[model samples]
Target: MGVGRILLNILVVLAAIAGGFYQLKLKPILVKFGQGRVIDPRGNTDCTTVPELKACEKLVLHQPSGVVYLACSTQESRPHWLPNAQRFNATGASRTDYVASYNPQSGKVTKLKTVNFNSPRGLSLHGMDVVASSSNPSELWVYLVNHREPLSGDPKVVGADSSVEVFKTTLGGSTMEYVRTVEDPLLLTPNDLTGTPDGKAFWVTNDYGVKTGLIRDLDLLGRATTSVVYCHETEGCKYAIQNMHGNNGIAQAPNGTFYVVNAIGGQLTVLEKQADNTLIITDVIESDRSMDNASIDSEGDVWVAGFPKALVLVYEHFANPTKVVSPSTAFRFSINTGPNSFYGQKFKVDRVCDRSSYTLSVACHRIT
Candidate 1:
């Protein structure tokens, strides 16, 4: 072959190698990041955007009263100090983040006053749960993932000194009393939590094992270092399930089955609680978008809120939530008792609602 012909052959070889790399490596990463995927928007007609509620990262409902408790902060603040997203501008973080309740029946939103809880940093809210008191139906137990800045160190360096804060409130009362803060090393980077009715114990999902590092970012690209930590008031916090990839919000069903969201990978992990309070993974439900939080309703259907465009959510919406619109999609997962159940499709997934907003958590009021 001539010199020009040999050069042409070399160029062809390089092109083939690049094509293989794109298919085997880069494509999966892009898909995981929700890039270039055609979004078929569904269930957009029924969602009603409450202009009063903005920038709530988590929501839990008091089923008996049809009240939804929200872990909320101003949209202006989340861009600066959302630790899970690694935007650790502590000075810009909201000091007055609050828990509010929305009554579907009355269509009234109330910001539950924090009584006797005086942390200097106030509440930098994230994932939360509001469980009815087992002993008294009139009382409610609130479990919050508080992402307070580190006491003695820089938040950018150490990440948020996150903890599960337990509180109590009445059925229809406006005041919520602070009980105690459960802080431990095992609460590495708590993203979301599911609490017991008594409020003495809870299971929190640590979205990242290594705090404030490159490894934490690599977790998006399949690093299985995230975990679920089980914390008790007296026993402290311990890892119930470890080496999980992209663990985010956790919701427990009425039957005691737990559904954990994989924030990056777009999957739901079904976990069963053991006798020792540890969780065993029983099944996985796959999805196409990145999910943030999961909530189960009175009927035992699991509802998940996800980002249709992950890049827009992280880069644009979180930065300027008011102006830029990031589409949020809610998925409903229920046991497939239909004909598909015989084909081994155990769960039926439906896109119940989709709207343009920074939706981090979701709760279903009815099956429709």
Candidate 2:
């Protein structure tokens, strides 16, 4: 071989050897550190344990240590305390509220990751995304509890309107800013969202006193296509709510059963949407007062977020027809602290994370 040709061949061999070494050794080391080393936020090896947390705040298991423990608690109304977890955003402009976090095992949150918003009143989570449903994916599935219908003699805004705005989310999993709102000229405001596993129609709560909730199916463009009701009077539903109006929290089981929980009367009512176009409330659990948000657990138990009360209640799993109407008392809540017992339960907004005033830059925060 020529001198220059031999030199080129030698250079190629060295490059290949270097590349192989990086692929096998250096690359993995870089990845390990890049993922972040699990530094114990608290230095103590002795983990402070609890008999059983009041409301079961959050169960986070670290990978390195193989240690399983509940996520440390925070002051009320704080978001993003636990990094890398996403939550359902509430309405209005303040920022994020109604936050939830995942188990880190299946990447599904047993607890709501904190999110901020201008309005905290209208926010909840099903603990599910429902990406896939029956034959096809669902278009629009929404639920609103304690929903006050316009027919109850409430004044309607003529120029302005009331509707549920939904959108197809962006690449990063964050929802697109602009949403297509389905204007329910008949109803006032919606509270939550619900649908079956197999793609079908969605349900919306209308008049509280009358006990009629609206059900509608949307198209790909976010247009309301099919709209109707799954009610007791119409179909002679087996399990129904009559006296306690105002439905608030909404959830659904894997078996296509609709679970609607109302705040006014504090009741949880379940119904099955029939092929013959009807709704039957198979079970009813009354007196679930102050219940705000709900999520069906991996074991099919329903978890409700009782705000102000700051309580998390869990209803046991159910099979098919014969049902457990309402979970009288399921789970509870408390403020978790460190080894020193420095932190306690945060009952009020001011005790936890709150906004600052002095500077225009929004730099003030007191984690007391």
Prediction RMSDs, each to the true structure: 2.6, 25.3
The 10-residue segment of model 2 with minimum total lDDT is 357-366
Q: How many residue pairs clash in each candidate?
A: 0, 40
Candidate 2's displacement at residue 43, Å, is 23
- Model 1 — which ten-residue stretch has the worst lDDT? 359-368
Q: Please provide, for model 1 over 1-368, each residue's C-alpha lDDT reduced to its tens digit, 9 standing for 90 to 100.
A: 89999999999999999999889876776676678865666666666557788888888877777778888899899889999889899989998988888887677988899999988978999989888888998899999999999988877888889888889999778889999998899988898998898879999999988789776777866889999999888888788999999999899887779999998888999999999999999999998788888888777888888777888888987898878888778888989999989999999999877665445445445622
The TM-score, computed over Cα atoms with residue i paired to residue i, of candidate 2 is: 0.37
Instruction: Assess each prediction's global lDDT (C-alpha) against the native.
Output: 0.85, 0.32
| TM-score to true structure, per model | 0.92, 0.37
Candidate 1 runs further than 4 Å off: 1-18, 357-364
